[model samples]
Target: MSRLDARFQIDYPGFRFDVACTVPLEGTTAVFGSSGSGKTTLLRCIAGLTRASSGFLQFDEAVWQDDASGIFLPVDRRRVGVVFQEARLFPHLTVTQNLKYGMKRSAPSPRRIEFDHVSALLQLEPLFQRRVSHLSGGEQQRVAMGRALLTNPQLLLMDEPLASLDRQRKKEIIPFLQRLNQEFRIPVLYVSHDLHEILQLANHMVLLKEGRVVATGPIQDVFARLDLPELVESNVVGAILETRIAEHEPHFGLTRVEFLGQSLFLPQQALPPGAPLRVQILSRDVSLAVGAPLATSSVLNALEATIAEVSESPGDPYAVEVKLDVGCPLLAMITRKSFHQLRLRPGQKVHASFKAVALN
Candidate 1:
């Protein structure tokens, strides 16, 4: 059962935003698209501030609104937390006071979470006495996160929460969000147009275009899919592969990520074997070859796989999806004309060539 379910149709001036999707109870679902794509609008509708002229909104098995008969819950009663692009803390308040504001706001009584848990998760102990205006951009974001989580909401919505911060600040705050998701099991809808953000944190993706939802699913399967070119190569479509560090070759400063226990080397920081790590392999980085090459200068991440399918549209790149017996999959996009030249077909064994730079 999903912890979040929502659908809405809203109009603002000449633009209309229509969205519908259910996200899993765990991990984050990145609502992605261009600035004008209405991703944020859809998020606002779910938050109950930008009421859709009509539709249904449900969270954690409770009906927030249903249109068959008129029913709408005010934002205050929705039990949903929101974190904005800017940390909108009260300037007069200290970090402790700001967080207490939400904790004190919970109805009936504050419940399910403690201020200490959120503080520890976000590393907030050091800033407890600091006024909101005195903190760094990243610290402010963390404080904002603590404020929201302390409320014990059924769902959390973040609308480009990192957009206002510089790259260094954004990088610092990412690990905290990942921890918040896992430690609390909070289902979050993170709206963003940034490719790097989506690749690192999202387990699922919901793509919006001109106010309508064009695609939604697990990041791995969705990245393996075709036709969302607007997203695939452009926004860095890919998945987070979890692997054990097989070994570290000290001389090369290289580490290997194992898929089904086979080691493939890539130059990376040293990590102990049996320690878990993640890798993001992009689609554009992948090139296909018919079989194992006898000799080549390319340090390709060679593996044996049967072509599960080959899709070559007129004038479109000859994109192929290969399935390895190792239980991991790779997606590659090549020129369609190259497909004809190579005489590639389904069920054929092929080498999926990729470079270290391609591994994000």
Candidate 2:
């Protein structure tokens, strides 16, 4: 199996970075953390742009670095393509020229991505003749991505490529990123602090904190951890569920999705039946009940669940996290007042319900 594995130990005057993780060389892998958390440092190390004094880095069967043996591959020697926060296109060149500049760097081997293929993949055909300065932020980023893909790289390193874009622009470019990930099947190491981006694009995740690896695994498994929201210092607490469209209820503007051994009703989606989708449900959106709530309630999902674990919520002195085993683990955030009133405890049975709209 193809994989990117690395273990690094870097020391500074007052800080030290100790990290080790492995990510599959397929689909996108997100390196997530807040600023000053060494996310970029880790990306640089993987790309061979920054050397780890004591480390081992390997891609599939090729070793990029091994300190014990005094081996380290330089950036140019590694078949890696990097995209930064900003689209560093040449101001004087047209989009076509910039893309060609990237293609020129290719070592002339049989290429998997061609100019026409990338142009179509990124929808860049019409923007080819336009100067880089004239395009929108989203357009420029798309071109940057197209340029990177033109290289036919073994690995792609993107460091917050959407950070410079506004909300609208980020929204505009996401589908293109998704398309590229699916079309090229390139191994990508994407770095970002934005949980939204990771939830949408990442299949595997590596969570970092203060220059250390906190967790690394499938995105759904990592996100479902009861302590993750506190560890990342963000309220992006949620569960990622991979489900299929089982049926549509047009009269009610609802869609039925099946997962594990149960089904859920969500806002109507235009997708055909049997289409796979990944849904995210925030913990705050879920409410717990000692018994089944009335059918008259607006909640559409009320599944029977057993308490897996209960823990105090950090930063919120009045709230607690309740992990529920409803076929799959689901997290619910409840106030201390409610917890005490309901007499909730571990190993107890309860009902987990949330509105259909909460299934995003």
Candidate 3:
């Protein structure tokens, strides 16, 4: 299992950034934090775009930077592809020319990412002859991504690539970004403050706060902790479930996904059966009952779960966070009133219920 080992210490007049973590070099790992939390700074350090005052960074077996040994690889020598918030395309060049420019700068004996394959992967064929200045925000971003892919990079660095786009444009580019990792097998360091984007794309996460590492691990494990106030404060605390499409019910306009011997119904998805899917159920969306729920209820999901842990919700005297084990771990946020009413405790059995639509 290849991994990225990083340790950085940077100082400015009024800010200090000190972070260290070992991130797996597989799938997408999100560098998540609020604005000014040093998410972009960490990314730039990895990309060799910004030098760390004193640091060490190693990708797998390659030591890109080691100040102790006076070894530091510059940006171009790193074979990293960077996509910024803006497309930053050449106004005078057509999309093909811009894409080819990246291809021409490929690293020696690089993993081959063919120009046609990149064009088709990013759906850039139609706009090949069109000037980048004439393209829409989403189209331009897609072209930018295609150009980056053609560079045959060892790793892809995206710094809020969708931040400048409107909601619809973000939606337009997300699927392509999702496919980039799956198809190219390129490790990605995705930096963003958007929890929704992180939920949708990241398998592993490195959480930052005040320029320091707050949490780091598989998304499921990190979110399951329920002890991080940053997440609780954001009011988006949840569990991430990795499931597979079991079947589709066209008559009911629903798709069934299976995980841990349990099934959940979601609004119809286009992916074929057996495809892997990641589902997020927010803590606030889950409800608990002392016994098995009745079939007469309107709520769509009711799973038998055991109370694994319970703790006071940070900054909320009236709320409590409950950890449940329904084959897979789940987090539920309930009022302190309900906590007393239910007599909840670790090792107690309970049923977790939530509406099917809540997952949407």
Candidate 2: the clashing residue pairs are: none
Top candidate, metric TM-score: 3
lDDT minimum window of 10 residues, candidate 2: 351-360
Stretches > 4 Å off in candidate 3: 356-360
Q: TM-score, each model?
A: 0.88, 0.93, 0.96
Which pairs, if any, clash in model 1?
318-336
Q: What's the lDDT for all of these models? A: 0.75, 0.87, 0.86
- Model 1, span 79-182: residue lDDT tens: 87999988898898889999999889886543488778888889999999887888998899999999999889878899999999999888888888877888
The digit string of per-residue lDDT tens for model 2 on 63-99 reads 9899999999999888888888899988988899899
Error of 1 at 12 (Å): 3.0
Estimate the overall C-alpha local distance difference test score of candidate 2.
0.87
Tens digit per residue, CA lDDT, model 3, 1-360: 999999999997799999999999889999999998899999999999899999999989999999999999999888888898889998888888898887887765636988888888889999988878789988988988888888888889999999999998888788888888889999999999988888889889999988899999998888888676555257555577888889999999999988788888888888899998887787889999987688788877778999999888877899998999988778898999999998999999999986443121
**What local lDDT does model 1 show for residue 290?**
74
Clash totals for all candidate models: 1, 0, 0
Every model's Cα RMSD, please? 3.0, 2.1, 1.7
